[model samples]
Target: MSAAKPTIAVVDYGMGNLRSVTKALEHVADGRAHITLTAQPEVVRAADKVVFPGQGAMKDCMAGLLESGLKDAVLEAAANKPFFGVCVGAQLLLDHSEEGDTPALGLYAGQVKRFPDGLSDAAGARLKVPHMGWNEVWQTARHPLFAGVADGSRFYFVHSYYMAPADAALSLGYAEYPFAFSAVIGRDNVFATQFHPEKSAAAGLKLLENFIAWDGQR
Candidate 1:
């Protein structure tokens, strides 16, 4: 009899697409763990690892969490378990968001902001606001999440808003889109990314594996 496998929960708050995320986790799990998609706070609280994946407006995201009554559970998990946040889920960890002027979970001291319009690159070329498609993520700090992941790995992104942490130390990855932006942020048990790992291919899976193996330590 060996140690029991870990149970990972992909939190579902009826905000974004949860199926793709759940399927992705299942793919990477490979029978090494149990993957669950849950909106119940109790179920989430009991999971060994938590993956909070979200997209869409911050107001709706926060509303979904609250409406589902999983906000406290998520907060508890963030402070306790090995936690992972993706996209809007990552943004919710901040203090506030400009999207509908939403007040987020505030797991970290920061704000989620909308990218400025009419922005241009060095060549006076126009850049989109949503910043969709695949973009390169440059690691800014050394952490287990980037264990097998290269310093500059491309990940799928789809969002109009981005985060800017008050404490720069919380920023672990950066991506340039005409201007530099924090693509990843982590500290202690919490690790988050603005991009979608499930959609990201090999590098993303590797990062998830590292997260699963992480013990929530420094």
Candidate 2:
């Protein structure tokens, strides 16, 4: 008998680029996974896994979640189901953000702040906001998210702010600007990536496949 397919809810918080994410997930899972793009809280709460994908300012994304009444549902989902966040969506899992002085979901104990001034040298060659385009993800620690994926894999990135989790042990991937910052994070069932895995090509697809196949017991 075939194994039961897991239902994944791609959260629609009015801030994410939903179509591309949905399309990429569909392709990787080969139609075996049920991907639902929804704003409904119950759908999120009921799903086997929840993906929080967004691209926008932190303030706007938080406000959208509250306005949609999905905040409570997300918290509940995180308590039980496997939760994944991408880009701005990943940053929201922290306690607060320096961006707009916004408070976050507080699922993880940490703060998100702007890249420090020292990140660049006197020449100012590396320090640029919204770090765009393809960059390499250096594996810092092994996690289920990195299963079937190797080190030095390049992923697409486009963001200014980055995450600094209090527990550095949760960090799975790091990227260099003038300094290194968290790229992929995995703590228990909560996983997030600062890069756009959906846009990262084959490596990205493999990461999604790993997430879908994740048993979530570890």
Best by TM-score: 1
Misplaced by over 4 Å in model 2 are 1-3, 117-126
Q: Model 1 over residues 1-218: C-alpha lDDT tens digits?
A: 11257889889999766998888778777877788999889999989999999978889899999999999999999999899999999999999999999999988999998999998889999989899899999988888788888888999999898899999999999998878889999899999999999889999888887766677776
Residue 176's lDDT in candidate 2: 84
lDDT of 2 by residue, 1-218 (tens): 12478889999989987888888888888877788999999888878888889899999999999999999988887777778889988998889999999999998888887876545745776566768889889998778878888798999999878899998887878988767889987777888999999999999999888878776656
Best by lDDT: 1
Model 2: lDDT to the true structure = 0.86
- Structural similarity to truth (TM-score) of each candidate: 0.96, 0.93
Ten residues in a row with the worst lDDT in model 2? 117-126
Candidate 1: what lDDT?
0.89
